[model samples]
Target chain A: MKSTYLALILVLASAPLWARTTPEELAEHPRWKALLHINQGTTWRYQGRSYIDDPDFFLHESGATDARAELEASIEQLRSSESEARCDFPARYRFLSQQLDWPDDGALSHCSEYQEWRGAMPEERVALIFPASYLNSPSSMFGHTLLRIDHGEDEDGVWLSRAINFGATVQGQENSILYVYRGLFGGYPGYFSNVPYMNKIRDYAHLENRDMWEYQLNLDEQEREWLLAHLWELEDIEFDYLFLDENCSFRLLELINLARPESGLMNDFRLAEVPANTVSSLDRAGFIESVDYRPSKANELDALVKQLDATEQDLALALAADHAVTEREAFRELEPRRQNLVARTAYAHLRLQNREGERSQAAAERGMALLRTINGTPTVSGIEPERPVSPEKGHGTKMLAAGGGMLGDRGFGELQARFSYHDWLDNPDGYLNGAAIEAFNARIRRTEGDDLTLEQLDVVNIKSLAPRNSFRKPVSWFVNGGLDRRFIGEKRHLTRHIQGGPGLAWELGPVMPYAYAMARAENNSAHEVLVSTAAGARAGVLWYADGFQLGLEAEGLYYHNDDRRYRPSATLNVPLGRNHALRARIERDGGPDRAETEFHLSWRYYFD
Target chain B: MRKTLLAAALVATSFGAQASAPGGSGCGWGNMLFEGNDGMPMHVLATLVNGTSGNRTFGITSGTNGCDTSGALSYHGENMLAQAGVMEEVAQDMAVGDGEALTALSVSMGIPAEERDHFKKTMHENFSTIFPSEDVTAEEVMANIQKVMNQDKQLASLS
Candidate 1:
């Protein structure tokens, strides 16, 4: 048998890598990247060495009245689920056979027979043999280190696989001819990606997988859109994924961002549209509870007026009086999802105004969010509320209950704020640039200094921040004035006006040292309409300095107006001290033109 | 019998012509070192003709100039000469080498490793960088290690 294999190897080794696909490559075929890793489970880690092996900790965490009962129940459920799910490998090897090959001690002989039977066919002279050790859930890591390779080779050339990333060298027995199946990348069902970056590949897969037909099922695009109508339903419903189990917590978030790649439109009604529709339909069908999120504007207005009367002038400030602008910016970026927290507080007051015994309405539209009242107090969770996860009720908290993410929120925000910066080293024409309005923000707070400041766990005075922002520019160079409704925690409020306008976007070029053009015609008095066109391209080696961002956007925007409006903006984001960002830009905003001649220099703390 | 031998020789000669084509012999073969570690017997895998030596027969654990890449030889017998002592034992019984060159070769040639982390930390990144053929990898060109293990001490296992 060994000699037969050796003879076969010699013939295969001598086989000139056929121009056509080889047997091994064809074995992997279109779905070669989909070998499941039958290991990497949480239970394996929980048993000992990696984490808490203490029985006390396990008992405390499980929260089950009876630990043994919980374990038995869990096992039963897993087996049931396993039975319900489709068996990945063919059925011939489902039961152990009498005699076969290496590793398998007289098991899966039928599998070998099957391989022989399949190999007998003339069209394709190959069979994908399933080693017996892998027959039981080949998706897990312990099941098998399986792979398919391109077996084409001339004595001169050989073909290899590029899917697997090995943790360490193989034991010389099996070649590193494959990529491992750690988990899903993007939203691809039962598949992994070979993309270079771990997260980047996951993100790309996420964005592309959103539109898969598997996600649609019998529902048309309109039904999907209908389900997305409610904010909660839109955010909560995941059609394509029959199982909510994503690659990992970190990967899930990265995939979410990937799915929502175009960050400029975060609250994009696209996904929300269908998810909301489903929630409404499901609620009507009595599957999920019909949440009450709608609250009256009158209730909010009344509460504001009463707070104004009740508070002494100094008593009302956004958070504590000791907090600085930097602190507020810190809070805004740190707790962006605090929008729900504030909404919950507002609903508390709205609930009081409701008629006796009548249910109060919900104010926020995101149906995916849940609101719970604790001793007449209310709060909200962004993705999933961290209430006691009632398995019987079929609910749980978010994977990222604590998004203690963002290495440097403040720094990241600042770097992001310089959003629309271009270095004219490359393209000189059609280019679009603008800082996302996530930069426009406020930190709301309330004060109770003279009162018995929470005597329990509460301190004499405390501060908390909540983020608020919204603004988009269309065909620029127009004055846009708006108002800021600031809040000091649960009480004091303030509103202010904002005014600014004028914006332009041009298409950059394929022409080397390209000269791009831009045209403007908004004759509104609130805005200025001056045809300003300037294109001078300089050649500088464009490359990224630190991290993955390419520092290659440089060009002089020379407006032909009386004063040459040169917005020569170039900012280099130097991740200096722990995301302690240092940015510098040089722009001749008004050089021999009537455009505003001001060198804009602004610096602020990023994440607190 | 003479005609059959001639026909076979003619067919083999035609292989040379085909080898010269794109994705042919020139792109095959990644750099392989005579790994001397633990109980591993140093065996020559292939002889690279960097300089001419008239193809004189050489024994295992023996080489005049083929081991030295800088030397000008016509044939490298049974192994791609490598800078010695490059492969090192990291910890207890654990060996690690800058096998990127081998890795790129393996990946490009479709020779997956039996032990994933065994010969990792590849230095040769681009499979196409060293060789012209897109079809070759270190796995295919690598001499069967078992053959190397079982061969006569005098004769190299592969070349």
Candidate 2:
């Protein structure tokens, strides 16, 4: 009896220490380190109290605190609770349970709702949803990324898969300027929201005309379960929204990294994260298994129109127009095959137009009638274009170019660098055709015996020319605001310029020609030096086949200060490899005082 | 306006008794956007809304279609593509009657609140003729709607 009492006392003494770990030992735990590394407990001042954006994720204490205390407290709670507690992250518990070799009791079975969701979303197959960049929308200019939990549904159920999306929840209505400012800074709180994949299709494919690319990931069931579990943990959790770094793509990468810690997808992105870059990282990590493309309504219509002859195209246009009876008569005259094509094309055209009320109603009814008439025969066929190389297969986002050539008789060495994104003149292979968006692009040149001069510094420049085709006619536009050096007298003067306008473009066979009328203003130390403004017109024609490209552009600038100038330029680009290209350019500038010509040859390298 | 009312009258006449039958359809005007077949008016409306409203239309439209809910009915346990097929069939004629397959679909293709009863009445009246049996398929429903339209003088004249 005396020995038994002593042994009981010894067992009781060690039980408390086993249940509650020391802060230092808890700090060494891998799960603890993972949570801290992800900024799980990072606190920010909001209103007055310190707020930890991740709601109920850390249960040791409210607000931001030490991870050690949280882990120790969690273990204590776990030991005392009869059932699995609701306060801890299920993934974390699973990790800790394995790390510490805890018993296989039902203590961690609290998350029935989440378990049900997980069962519905089979972890065997997963896909990454990338809504390719739509330059027209400011928010989508950088593109967006989401994760799809594919449950292996049938063809129709494929769209029923659940999607994990992280986006900023705008707190209140604000003006455009304020909204932009808030979006850039941390004024909004970003959160993870789950929805069916079909909704995203409707938004991007049908409404916004942005194509979606699905890249199925090659993760094992274990890795996929980890991803789903972490995503479930992130549900309804808020994170400070920073447009540059902690945006949608960045958060998605972090989530992916949590699943495969050694993959280190987040490490490559330090300051900025682009959706395409993350995709490239996933590819590099050997996560991508296969790729599929879902063409937008506009894409299909564009492709279909190319197959039609001029007469068939005109018939399609008539069917899409408001004259219902005439269009019907014209539609019926075509052969069955032609009729089917025209009816489908007309329907797509009308939908793209998106009219309203009774007139649209009648045209829709009429379009349906045409389709119904053809349904008895055979349906129109949809011929899909060969999917372009995946965005991951494209050249990297960061570009560096170095070359030396004669500039107006002066031998100068020019170095150009672009921090992020694509330019039209660049190889248009893994990007949207006729679309360009660049940030922090600069060109510096040093004369043979002179100091380096900043020839151009563009903060942001975006241009989208969705060429007008028979089926759809969308406005083509360009907006460029930056600083440039203009040759004034004998030297160059730095001038700030803002220019933008809308125009039209058409694709004729292998060549696409475009024109834009723009209002441009340049302030060169306005109060001290030359101040000039111009309403200008620019025309360009581009011919591209395979990987070779040649472009010719002419611009006539009518200045308010009588510095009227006309500039014509031609460019030839040849691709050297997947990530390298050589570009040659020659330009002639004609102004009131004199006429000068310049030439440049540059070798460009891209890095992702 | 006269032409539109006539079309509506023709639809009403055909669908009057069986509008609320199982799998009965609605006006299906909203799908003009979904099917990429909007008329001039719908196209104009879509353009106006797409320009100014951002994704509000997505919220409105998807929510109307039961996309906002987790337990959305599948096309007889079929996948998304099959559900889309059914939607296309329903778009052919919104005025049809109730059936087991269309319960989920009708919720998705919600008519204007005020027009629900009239739309339902139209579907109830046309249900038996459209279905003819309990196991009627979407393709059958579409073919039947096409037949009804073919038989109507006003609709046939326009076609």
Candidate 3:
């Protein structure tokens, strides 16, 4: 009788262990934690809390903080036929059923809403769609990333594929300043949205004139299904949108990581996230199976225009400007093929012009006429834009440089660190050429027998040198605001300044030369005036190649206090490899009272 | 049997929602082509924020809400190319006689692989009829495409 009682007790104790997954164990599971978006206490303030900002996402009262209790409550709710947990959290139900070996009671099978939604999307493949940077758009300047859920085997079917995007929700009438301020400080709520891929293409390629790169992932069938299921759970869920770290690219990475937990794509990015850097991370993680490029409409137009001769180009431009040009002798004399090319170019130009602002009725009519003319002729060979190097092949966004150089008369050892993004002299392989966007760039120098001093701190500096041709005339512009060491009278003082202007750039052979008429405001400590404003003009020539870049620039500024300053600089950058480069600069600073010449040579290392 | 019935009911409800008003009144033919343009400040703001102003779609339903279900060209519940921006691309591609947009439209229309070239050719030939005017609605364009497809022996079955 005693032995029987002991055996019975042993069976009861072991039964609890073998029969089901403990709430504690299920709470700590990687997949469960991922579904809940629970951070592993890595982020300082958000440790052990869910990343989801919305309270509705959690089932239990303490669900956001206490995973074990949430799991227990969720299991109870899922098992109860009276509750809507199975329908509301289908992914959780599916996961729990597998883990707990629950009976096939058709509980989840009866989740009609989820079943119908799942039935609609029979996706078997996924690709990461990255729209390259558009300098005209401040938010897109860092580039943007989204996912495309592909169905069927047809290559053309990609246009119909569903795109999953995460972005901030903003009021329609928000001004640009408020938009930037809210985007930077996480004042807006970000949500996941699924739209047709073609809409995204229209927005990125046709409207914004940005090229897109598609990185088809190598996820298997089961993994793809899990991603889709998780995506459903995230429907209508909100997250705090922080531009630096928890932005669009970061959210997409989270989704990809949840799909294949082993990918661990989110482990490295801690401080800030840039869209291009995420592509490099995915490539490093071996998630990319293949890469494809889709050129923008502007690129297509450029290619079409290139195929025409100088005279034909002029005719094409004239035809686009005025549909009446088609009746002219110069247009009438062209061969059928040349006429088709010109007509096609004209149509593309009209479409691009109509993309922004109010569409002129005349432009629309011309577009239709051109299309009709093109349709009447035999179809020529299509134009394919030349693909540049992939974004992953470019140098990393964060840069560190170490060197020593002569500042005025003293020898100084300088350390420069740019928090994010490329400059004109940086390797331009994977980035936009003639465009420079740098944020939080800081330089420190220690002169002979002197303490280390902050040389310069640039909060934001953006330069877009869009070279103009006969076909399209884009204005080149630059804006820079920062603190820099400048000579006020005879002493070097750190001054805060903001300067910007609009200019024009033209490409001549291998070089692009630009000139800008600039306005500036400065707060200088050594200056007699508390705040000094200036009017200035700058001219620069940039010659860039695959492995080397050289720039010569000069500027003259006349301050409100009648002090005049001139600066001329020559910079050369030679990229040794993808991530290493040697840069040298010789600059002369001419002030009202004195002039100083300085030289700097540095080896730069690029990293994410 | 019960699960299937429930699934049917759910699908019916979703379809009902879609049929009633998918994209609300804001999704009209007039707003389709020039939808993104909303004056200089809004345009500049959109460029800077990259946010979809007042767009709150969870992607549960079909992504497109511009399809006119009342039209005869409604195939498979939603017309994939009904969005104005995509319609514009389709019109352009149809004019070219061959392009990605045209091929995508053919695929969406359920045209077989072998019949796609014939469909493209037919659409190319009928570009003027399909896009009668720049202000033509997506429903009209889709109807014209269907009519053109029906006339072609190879693509009639797809229509």
Candidate 4:
């Protein structure tokens, strides 16, 4: 299962088909598809509204989801309608006055005619409720099972999810909802006790994407980069997103590229105290603020809750006095509210009392504040925006150079050996560019047994636009493959093959859909043939906007391999440099064996 | 809208049967489990039907139908007792015109006094409350139940 999943990841990752078939598959996943298709042929902007329809709550914070504002207006309408309801619906209104409680069980199975399409959806249709549910069923946390529905018959349907997870990105997909948050993978779990029914619900979601990669999120600095590269290598497989459950917060920050973007790193410690700053011991003050929040004894909410609790108690007593109730009777009515106030006071008091005592609260709070100082904030001191805290002082590579290989073009073989080095730019946007080859090399094992030896530097190009703010610059890509027929001993029998191509690259957003198209040539030394062409294309979106790149290419070959059985095939028609891209690839020759199905995965690097 | 109305009609026609609930003190497993007038009993599978689109969908409604203790449930006399309890509750709650009580008694399955209460509560809450009736005699309730279940086709206008 694991291997099959790995193979699937490699295959699906490489296929550039973000735009493909639907209509039929639409029936199966109507909700999510509906959200996408709703504003088709529309750009990122429609009128003044954003064209990006990720029904998640991000837009809700801005109060943008209510396009018509009917709900907003309903609140005002309620006041005036009360008079008419009292006059004409005395009895009808009475039922609603206390909110008639029906048998919860009876209602679950039987929805009234009043419910519309998004009715008691559990039975109507299976809804893919996102971030609302992580792993366990709501029964554990909430008493009953919660199934999200946008519309329903008797119940207020039209809501998105029935069951939800905490702090999840519950997007309202047209056909189904999906969570895109950090620590959510695995699959939705049903309630612990609901057994058979809950089990059935789990079975319905069908989360058997056997190829998902699992890793602990709490890795140290070196291991963090180490794992990210591994994640990048296995990018060929399809997955919703990576969930850095344990250390996602910091792990994600470390992956940021400050150089290409901002082109500098904040003095992680006190800038003045930096080892190189020996001047005044890098003013610890400069960094102390980064890890600390300006703390005050009394917070705004703490003061407010205290005052409100007292005020409410007094009001309750006054109300009782006005009605002439027993002191004890009135106190009961006012008690819970007062208790609620007390709870708030206790919470705030603890926050203030727990300041900087023996516990590390003071230190942790200071640390958090310090992070905010340097996070996304421009400099407060005289530091240049592009200045690095340590600069490239400790950053240099000892390249493991590779000896040149021979490439036989048509009739003759050519050999060339060269040296090249790549640097690790802390910008995530450059994760796919040809600049960060150094970082890539540190992660995966492209070569077996021994540490990978970098041979001749055939090509490297890494460009940056706003690297931080603006994501418009197009980074070019280049690839070179060469064959070593001799001297390599064990690899002697294999003909040397080398090919290089360079093209433009662009990322739609940070860790988002990325693309690069380049033209290049390939040659085999032992076979004595050089095939060249500009008709190759590779493209696919990175999953969850992560650094994983997926692409597919169909190229017309310059020279075909003569393995008698395994014919290396590429797809294209225009003999060589047609304006058309590397078209739909076809496996024309399945080697000497008439028919075969196969997929390939290659590790990559970017040197900026 | 159409689905909701259709679903409502099915609810109306099913003629829910409820049994009176026996008293509450340290009730045994069966008593505590079956006390649910609103939800499914622990062992008793509740077949909830939510028919929208007016499609009267009949999902496998497997249970001790008729409460006859046959099929896989034949071993337990609970079904038979439950059925009789239901009939007794109806007869007791809706005692009819003078001589009618005797006739109902003849047809009654003879449930115990204790079990009768369970039927009454079940009937009241398991949704027998849908067709509201005030001061309905014993024979009338029995007759109505029979007619709904297709055992008796006769209908008597209130006098």
lDDT of 1 by residue, A1-608 (tens): 53354345434433443224333442221111111111113222122121212232121334123333322332233233233211212221121010111133332233332233223211111111111110011121011111111122311111111111111111112211221221211121221111111111111111111110001012223222212111111111121111112221112221222222122111111211112122222233233321211112222223332333222212222221222321344334423234223323333223222211111123111110112111112222222211221111211111001111111111111112211112222111111111111212222222222221111111011110111111111132212122222112222122222223223332212111112233322122221443223333322222332331223233343324432223444444443333233334443333331322212222323320
Q: Model 3, retained fraction of real contacts?
A: 0.22
How would you encode candidate 4's per-residue C-alpha lDDT over B49-148 as one tens digit per residue?
1110000011111111211112111111222223212222222222211111222222233333344443333333322321223223334454444444
lDDT of each: 0.21, 0.60, 0.74, 0.23
**How do all the candidates rank in terms of lDDT, highest first?**
3, 2, 4, 1
Per residue, candidate 3 scores C-alpha lDDT tens digits across A185-255 of: 76777777666676677667776678999999998887787788887777667787778777788778888
Candidate 1, after superposition: displacement of residue A108 in Å?
A: 9.7
| TM-score between candidate 2 and the true structure | 0.78
When only the first chain is scored, the TM-scores of the models are 0.22, 0.89, 0.94, 0.21
DockQ sort, best first: 3, 2, 4, 1
- Per-residue accuracy of model 2 over A1-608 as CA lDDT, tens digit each: 53354345335423545345445754544334444334432222232222334545666664244666666666666553354453235676655555455677774455455454554554557788887866465456667788877655232234545567776654323565665676667676666666556556655666567788999888777777667767655554567666676677767776676666555454332567778888988998788988889877678777778778898888778777743633466656777777666666776677666422332445545555544443433444446655776787788899999987787778988999999888887887778767789899999999888998888999989887778766667788888889986655444568899888888988876688999999888887532445577898999988877878888999888877667667899998888887899999998876666667879999999986
Expressed as tens digits, the lDDT of each residue in A1-608 for candidate 4 is 53354345334423443123232322112112111111211112232332223332111333233332311222222223323212222222221221222123222122222222113222322221111111111111001111121112222112111221111111112122232222234232111000111111221111100011111122233322222222221111111222212111111122221101121121132111111121111122121111111111232222333355454545433422232221345334544435333323332233233221122333223222222221212212211112112211222222331112112211111122212223222222201222332211221112323343332233332221212111113244434344322211113233333433444443343333333444444443434445523343444332222322232233222223333322233322111111111112223223222334322222122111
DockQ-best of 1 and 4 = 4
True contacts kept of each: 0.01, 0.05, 0.22, 0.02
Looking at model 1, give its docking quality level.
incorrect
* Lowest summed lDDT window (length 10), candidate 1 chain A: A207-216
Residue pairs with backbone overlap in model 3: none
Q: TM-score per model for chain B alone? A: 0.19, 0.28, 0.58, 0.22
Name the runs in model 3 displaced over 4 angstroms.
Answer: A1-20, A41-45, A81-83, A175-177, B1-78
